[model samples]
Target: MDSSEQQDNLTESSGCAQAALFGPFQLIMKDGAEVLISNRRARAMLAMLCLAPDEPIDRDHLSRLLWPGRFEAQAKASLRQCLSDLGKLLAAADCDLLDISRSRIGLKAGAVRTDLSDLHDLLTEGKYLEATERLVSIGAIPLLDQMNYGEAFDDWLSVHRQQAEQRLQSAVSVALSALEKGDNLSEYARLSSLWSVRHPPAQTIADRKQGKVRIAVLPFKSIADPADHGFFADGVVDELITSLGQVPQLLVAGRTSSFQFKDSDKPPSKIADTLNVSHLLEGTIYRQGEQVRVAVSLVDAESGFESWAYCYDGSLDDMFAARAEVVQAITNGLSDALKLTEHASQPRKLTSDRKAYGLYLQGRALTIRAIGDGVLPTAIELLEKALEIDPEFAECWTALAEAEINMTVFTPCLDRLERCEKAAGYAKKALCLSPQQAHARIVLAFYAWTQNDIIGALDLAFEAYRLEPNNPDVLNRVGSFLLYCGRSRDALPYIEASIDQDPVNGRNYAILSGVHLNLGNIEAAVEAGQRMVDLGFPSLWLAAALAVSGDREAAIETYQLTKKLMNTVIYPPAGSAPLNPDAMDAYWLMAAKGLWSGKDQDRKNYCMVLEMLHATLHDPCDSTIVLPAIWMGEAPMVFKTLGTQITTANFFAFMSLWTNAEPINRVRLHPDFMDFVERIGMVAAWEKYGWPDLLPKPSTII
Candidate 1:
């Protein structure tokens, strides 16, 4: 029968019967009374039918699954008894929810409303909003959490559960597309946050090719008095992972993913299963003053057995040699254990001076942390000291450059432009010494973008990607630069690839969100934004996305949260404060008020605050007024603000403004819009690449 006919039959026969397949299995009848089926096999049969509504399962197959080890006749009898008992319970509840035939049985189409069935219907109907809402309410609870039959049924259940998860993910994607098309920002944000909470970005064994050997290097335990040498052990592991990652044949788990299991009491097999690796490498470090002892072991994740083991002893005076010995031994051990042909290349020493190398490690670790007061400044000091000790330490220069660039964001009181310039100098020095420094190239790319050299930025970014194709940071930088140049379609693959490699990095998600947002994929944008928030990254971009998506309340709340985080958790160094604290406070206050009110006058008030802050800070390219002016429907103010930024050769803020959102379209529809694009060099970039997803070619811009 057609769907409508089935619906009519269901309405007449199944009175108020609903099946809850997600979480604990429940069959609720009329008046919210749940029908209790004490038979596990009966419940499993019902679940199978519910999952495949309207699809018949063979009686033989069902019997085998329900009674795996029993004789065929016995299993058939058991299945018949279970079916009879289930039918009687349904009859008592006044529900005709089953479709039984001579040789097959199934749940009748539309016989009983189920969360899974409803989700499928909504998704099929292209009603992404409702589908997303349903998913949000369902809240990550797996299908039939309490029901497990025999081995056959359990295996069948596992496959079906995986299918359910895939369907839910598909619903999320489709809903994001629908929401993007409808421009429903509020629901988009809500749904995206739910998606983030439900599905964090992490790679599984499925991400690797079949038969590929994957491994995770767990953190080395430090067996030292006071445990003060833990950082040293961590640094050793970091270098070890980097060295192993260079072996093209090995699929190494990312440091972020591996470090998550630090001090975990879980067994090697379980940890390996979680990390989706076939093998694991774990070790220990013992330090007494300058003297150290290191022991390492490689374990087969399946059996949790030690495949190989090694030990090394060295003093801090010969740390580099010791680290090289340890790395070589591990690589050789892995090669023998896994029967690999390819070997890891020789380790590249950052510096010959042990003190300088140790200092560099400490500084690099702090730079990677990149948060808390005085952290970045302390890193910079240590890096500088390392450089002083070894003037030709190219890696130290890169570390310093990274630390400097981070200062612009984490230590907001520092002069941003000055930091960029310093970063540029350090990056160039590093590049001069070692031309293949992808990190240095990435730093230079950002510096070039800040200096309004879009083409130069793109070139540097692409060059870095070429140098380090599998490097997540390089991939993210390339994607981010492409995004800034209004190339969201081109940026997506790189962003996705980066996420695949380094799923936990919040900055990756931030860029991913921006790419989706500019492409008008509101659901995906919000999803990435939520992930960014979860990763403890700045939520300002997410707030902006919510604002544009028409979620004013969420936008304001996110903005306020971001402001609070900046003031409290991400404060500047002790000696430095904002040059104009009152203006800064007023700036945040007015922005929040405008976002909350969403009124023209309130937005205009925010524009005034931006102007005041601009004047107070002496920044001619005050891009802060553009969004407020757009919100105020003051196209002239938008043009004026953008024109000032263009005149001053600051194209950094223009990246986010090039969109077809209603607020942004107001700026685009202005008579001078084409002239503005021409002046900003976007016309050239678009011509060379392709037009933005939402915009017309310059020739078509009437």
Candidate 2:
């Protein structure tokens, strides 16, 4: 055969296989001709198998997913028919796509290529910009578009997409950071240039002449053997950060961001620019026999000058005392250099036992990373072990509480109410151990919010923020709560402060996006949302913000791609327990319809669902159900819920939503609302926070 004919034959033998589910479920093949399958179930089955290429899915699980409401026998029979049809379809297309057996099924290894697989590969290779471009190009493709497979499948797809988006987002962030530092410039120039010009990062500390004193404490260098003294070196940096973070006027970079430069050969000036810190602290630790030696210095970001230097020598047994001494010296030096009063010359010690303190530091580090899904239990174990070593360790208790709350709120692997109860217990114990513990206060604030004690929650959140002004965790928590409660303007400064302290943190960007969205700063919100995606903390807020900001086409596209995942989790199918479906529904309506434009019937249906959820579940607060009820014109249901809330001292919490003008203002005319509001001290809160403009003028006392 001629060369042209041979090339054609080779092309025909390399049968094309296409699979994508980000928007629509699309699967096809071509051997010089396109292959089409008419059966929807067959197509869905192929997609499912292809989604987990090379991993065998049990027949029972596949049956349940494909026929959620069917009996086992009937479901398995249906699955068999689908598999047979899919096998024949692939064979006709000249593709070897399935590996089916009596007990298991999966896509044939190396025989198929999928968008999902390609996206995952890009993320794994750290090609964030490429991954992002691929995702954007997919443009709101729904997972298995419009397929009625069942809620089981829906729920799985939701989590699957969420995870994928998170990976892509993380890649974006790392890529952007790399670009900023002149790494892989030519390779990622397109993404870097586009993102840099379109969504410039928050101004770095080097760009700002005046603000809170920003600082980064670099991980200490270890001169001793790697295994024995490595933890000691880390412990010192962690301790110093904790001690420095107590100063209200200072902004301390989080360990995760600062420690990224451990053993880095980059100059101090370069490190400062990368970390966005005006000042840097460098240190070294060396342990030999019974003696421990430490050396440290502070550097000025702009001048690249060493401002101060210190060395400490002490017995390894006296490490805690020596640490206290060193901390006092650093704080004094920093206070002098910054022209600010030192909050305390000596930082408060967490634990007197050096071994216990080391364990606590280890646990603390783990908990910081525990914010990611499925990682909380590990942190919880470590924190609990640390507490066991020193039961009176108030900080350990607080850490445990924080981890429990994260597991409950951020992950769906645990019983939420149970986790909440455990979190409250830990927080209370921490408070009892040390009444001034800021983290415990924040945990209690979360408990208060859950219980519908909005007034108490806000009070606690503010108290925690005030106590630990430089603590990024507390700053973000307070800011997030304020934003959620319709105090976006008030929340902005706190959120910005957190970003200043932890500029590279994905969580900080996420909060910034929410704050911007709440303030109706569309461009800022979009930029922040994109930054979050870049940072690999994918969330649905960006799409909602775009929708609310009048970018209908983009919003709809994003929504279509994410709706299944959003819906599965927000409006969970029967038999699954979501943390708070009522709240999720309220959030969904707000995100999808600008919080103010749901159809009357849609609102009513959601209100009904909310009522059912409230009745069936242990809802400590009325706020979740009340807003949706009010939004949907279900005045009677709202009033009834408020009545219960008032009786339970949750009235203040219900009134918390009253500060949100767009929805709350519209409900003031409900005859029963004003009477309930007066009885619940709404006037006092309004006086303090300023009244929502649409509230009725002061009328006759109820």
Candidate 3:
């Protein structure tokens, strides 16, 4: 058991677990019921350094082993950050995990349990060969043994995949071994199969049902002779939907959600099945002069029981009142018969500007159905006219903001940021007037994000979600921000949640695409990217993901196709927020100062675009987002240039990425970058806007 003999035995051994003597440490459970476990690397690092006990591990060898594919200086800096984070996490647990100095890190012997020691103890217990085999089978040793090179990140990705596969293999082996050694395997297998059925087997998210309610507001047949007042029948259907929604204990189907079944040859049972409703409400409306008659009957979906029937007549002016009466009667019937809870509707004074509201609703109606030839333009014109008549209207402003935001997708702009800013302004105004407005808040956040103010956008998005927890747009923005933050794994759950809330929304499809890209999940990114493209938005960002996820050829092709589509199909002239390569003065400054690690042609084209963008950078404000920082070397280089000369005050201001200063971060930069120090000076900026985890600090110069 001498030290030298022990070390030799550990090194020569292979398979699962190997043991070497290490120090004793304490373990404490936190008040929050959370476990505080030492990271494998931290424990290993400590033990290695502790080999010389309380002395620093040689920085060079440490960096080489700990952070492969990273610059030595950069790796050293990250080790500092990792230690800092671990210190904070442990300090909260009242554990002093490390004491660090110029080049050393050491753990207090009593601070925490060393899992490495535990694994060793377990391996040394009786079945040494079996334990070693298990550790090797699990692949931790391979990960521990790796000493990666900077020029081979793709190889790192391979290592990551191999590590994952090895983990699965190890897990299966352990499970099988336990099965062989223990009993009652039948229950575990059955439970595992049952649990698996509760969720989708792939990346596709399955929608879960929330609160359920059963009631139907029967569709009313038109009594206005079918020839003249065709619009009146629609109005009656609309009024009923509005009135029924006032009841909280109801999932009343909207006219749009219901009318699809109209005139279809489908039977009532089939219609009910399609709507996913538990009851059917069918009725008719007839108008004779100033008076109108409406009839409705509720049919149970499951038992086929007749729930109730109702009829109403009222003068034209009291038409709305009559509709309200029908809603009240249905709720009263349900309460009296089924003993269900009744929700009271909150009363509000009708808006004073009824004429303007009418026009606005008309515009909204067009906008909601604003699909097909001439529909979008017609909706925009109507909304514009409504705004013209009542320029200060909050809802109208929000709607206008949405239309304009959508407009940028298909139309070219002199500057996308400028147009996006204008949309943001409108949304902000809408929020100012009605702070509880969900749609406006969602749009404002989206605007902030596109403009690269990620923290601001996320705050607004979360605020919007709080205002209307079920708001699909808010969830979509949250999902998008998660991806932007490089929490793609986290983003998937959020985006998937949005789809569950509003599966039919084309916008959610877009957010899902970005989440996939964030995970470096290339095929999934492509699938979701195609969905977004088919749903009619540019996939420039998606193309970038495709490029990095080892699909450079497809990415190049996607770029060519998207460019052609923007020119020929989407816009004929001034085809996009065109970046004119001819306009840049210092284009080669970027190319000459630094180089893109991408394909040479990509480098060439990107350098050309950077030239155009750089000329605009001289302006006090530039429309170019920091997206250039992501895709190529242009932005960081310019930021480097600005850092060298920009005034101290301006430099400080530019450091706040959350406060309308950070450039859009589209590319997740590689860590071996020269700008890490400057990027550190502007850390707040990148954290609030750039890829959060991948915030590669500018490298330290020797």
Clashes of each: 1, 7, 33
Model 1 lowest lDDT segment of ten: 197-206
Q: Per-residue lDDT tens digits of candidate 2, residues 1-702? A: 112322343342332565654433555453333345667667677766666565688999988987888999999999888877877877776678777788888766667666666666665677676655654344223334445566788887666655555555566677657766877665564453233211111222123325568889999998886555477788878778988877656778987778778889998889899788889999888888768988888899899898888788888887656677777777777777778776873354367777777676666666777554446677787778777788988878888898887665555432565677788899999888787677898888777655546556655776675456567777787666655444565567768877777777875775687667656577897888777666665545566467556575675455444434433534232234554656655545543443334355544555656767677645523444654454344556666676454322132233224333234345556777767555544444333332332342242011
What TM-score would candidate 1 get against the native? 0.62
Q: Rate the local accuracy (lDDT) of all candidates.
A: 0.70, 0.63, 0.49
Winner by TM-score = 1
Instruction: Estimate candidate 1's alpha-carbon lDDT, on a 0 to 1 scale.
Output: 0.70
lDDT of 2: 0.63
lDDT of 1 at 624: 49
Q: Lowest summed-lDDT stretch of 10 residues in model 2?
A: 196-205
Per-candidate TM-score against the hidden true structure? 0.62, 0.55, 0.51
lDDT of 3 by residue, 275-338 (tens): 6677787777777876777776777888777777777778865765444555567556655555
Candidate 3 global TM-score: 0.51
lDDT of 3 at 37: 34
| Model 2: per-residue Cα lDDT at residue 27 | 56
Q: Which lDDT value does model 1 have at 413? A: 41
Candidate 3 overall lDDT versus native = 0.49
